[model samples]
Target: MLDVAINHAVVIDTEKSVEKKINIGIKDGKVVLLTTDTLIATRVIEAKNLIASPGFIDVHGHVDGYAYSGELSACQGITTTVGGNCGLSPVDIADFFARQMRDGFVINQAELIGHSFSLRQAVGIADPYRQASPEEFAAMEQLTRTALQAGACGVSFGLDYSPGASFVEITALANVCAEFNRVMPIHTRLFTQNDLYSLFEVLAVAKRTGVRLLISHFVYQYGTGIMEEALQIIDQAIENGIDVKIDSGMYTDWTTFIGTATFDEQTIADNEMRFSDMVVASGKYLGKRLDRELYLKMRKHYPNESVICFMGNKAEIYTALKKSYAMPSTDIGTYKKGEGHPQIAGSFPKYFKEMVKERGDLSLIEAVTKATLLPAKTFGFAHKGVIKVGSDADITLFDFEHLKDNADFPDRGKPDAKPTGIEYVLVNGTLAVDQGGFTGEKAGRIIRV
Candidate 1:
């Protein structure tokens, strides 16, 4: 008997961009059968009128080992998450995975060894504005290689947070990623709102190092009036034979720690961002808007607290993700129960609702492909993004007609509110979300690329 059988569902074949009514059988954490015939299983789900597809893979997130974040991700049909984004990750990649394996997690996690913050700090470079010494750069390179050898999926850089990270330091670590055939994801340095030069810098690195480059959170960086120009540049880079891809979320507003250089007074003034546009997403001042006094308090005492900045062109969000090389991402961070951005629970569902169902910007097949196979191919998770015989039995079943994201900003509504119409989610052949509620299944594995 099969371990689980999902019968009579409209299954999306991401590879072929087609949908068919099929019955799927799973056993030993792999898809064993796909057919019209009925099958017996230890547990069977009748899933008529629902759309079944390979589980969503989040290409950019900060949900490294946080259980609540994992729960929120699974609730939104994300079965595999690529964490250690934005240059922040555990120093010991192996230990992070080992701990997750020891004490099981809610979804599969593949990590990226971080450069700007984690690796730099690990090498004893304390100041973000100071260049790393030659010895420190060598040490970071060695640690990056060790992490990659120990199963890190890529190397990530948050250049804005580490303004002093020299291009030489970046290319050195990027070369190691290329040597190992791993991806290099960069959060570019946004010196100002109009910094197209930042994007070019990253493109230049990809051009020089010959490494596979993934730009983390494109919309957040260029969703201003410059999105058209940014997309044009990306298109040009791809045409020039540079392997470039980007990830974005549905919302125009973005969130990060208030203490980061991105939120510094000087950076804020340079970008012409209003203090009124920033809202506290976490910590004691959960929903309060940041004025001069409150902003200074948070920056000084609560530097690690997350703040949501509402900017960017809403139309540009759709425009960016409409690109063939663009994938949807959450940028989900570790947060307490009521303290975080709505993207944690809303991103994937919102991606479908806004891009496919409501706007008609993307067909259902195209939307599913971006959220599934595109990221899988980008990250090289060969077995996790397709629904076929012998593939990993990680799946999401949703009613597209009723799909909607209920989570809103902190001041607007419950930031972590669960979405609607996601019927069931499975991770490694184990039921994780049943009838829209999390089933407390720790079936997820640490995916070492």
Candidate 2:
């Protein structure tokens, strides 16, 4: 007998561009079979008129074991999230995983050993405007090796947040990642408006160390109308046999800390960004636009607050996602019920609705593959991204016609509105969200690389 059976469902197999009605049998958290065979199960879910695809994997996120954020991710049909992105993460990967396993989470999480912020702070590299000394670099390398051995999936760098990082620091870290065969997810350095040199810096590291590189949030990095040129660079690198890929969210604007190097007055002037173009995304000034006075006040009082910078072209978002090597990401973080970016609650649903159902740029299968198999393959997770027999029993059921992202920016409306038409979400053979409602069960696990 199987633990659960999802009967007569329209299963979307991401490996191939096909959809068929199949009955999936699940036992011990794995798919046991997929057939018309009369299978008996402890509990059976009748899934008619619903499209069942592998649960979405967010390639870039910052959940970092935050409970509310994990719930938001699960509610958005994301069964797996790659966290500790953009230079922020818990210092001890092993201890973080142990605690998650002990308390039980709401979705599968794979962590990366973060640079720029977490590792730098751990090694006592306090200055963000100066390169680390040789001794500090050595200490960082040791800590990085320890985290890699403890099962961190990759090394993450937010170079823009740490402009002080030199070639030696980046190359040394990349060398460690390459030696361990781990991915290097880089949020490249941006020193000026429309700067491609920052992207090239990461490419240079990939060229030097031969590390597998996953560019973090392509739209945020190059969505300033240079997406086509950036894609060409990535294509040329791949042609030269370099493994380079990117993940992007559906939004053009991106959010980050107000006190980071990226938000410094000099950076704002160099990037040609105006205070009016920035909006307070979290904390006391939640929906207010930025000004000199407000910026100074927020920078001092709310240093850790998040602000959304409106700096990218909308057309570039589609341009990036249309690439074969690009995967959809959320870049989600922990936020309170009514405070956060809309992408946290609406990215995957918006990807399907806009790219597939509205614009017809991608077929449903292609979009699903980008959201599912592409990420799974990138992370080397064998059993999590496909709806085939013997795969993990993580699945999402939603209506193609009715699925739409209702969440918008704070000035527009609520940022945490639950999307429409996500019918069911399951994690490890257990219902996390049922019929558009949370089930109050945390069945997620920490996935060690």
Using lDDT as the measure, the top candidate is 1
Q: For model 1, how does the per-residue alpha-carbon lDDT over 1-449 read when each residue is reduced to its tens digit?
A: 99999999999999889999999999999999999997789999999999998999999999998999999999999999999998999879999999999999989999999998899999898899999889998999999999999999999999999999988999999899999989898999999988999999999998899999999899999999999999999999999999999999988899999998888778999989898999999989999999999999999999999999999889999999999999999999999998899999999999999889889999999999999999999989979789999999999999999999999999889999999999999999998999889999999999898
Candidate 1, run of 10 with poorest lDDT? 260-269
CA lDDT of each prediction against the hidden true structure: 0.93, 0.90
Which runs of model 1 end up more than 4 angstroms from their true locations? none
Error of 2 at 423 (Å): 1.3
> What TM-score goes with each of the models?
0.99, 0.98
Clashing pairs in 1: none
Stretches of candidate 2 exceeding 4 Å from the true structure: 37-40
244-321: candidate 2 lDDT, tens digit per residue: 999999999999989988899899888889999998888888988999999999889899998999878998889899
Error of 1 at 28 (Å): 1.2
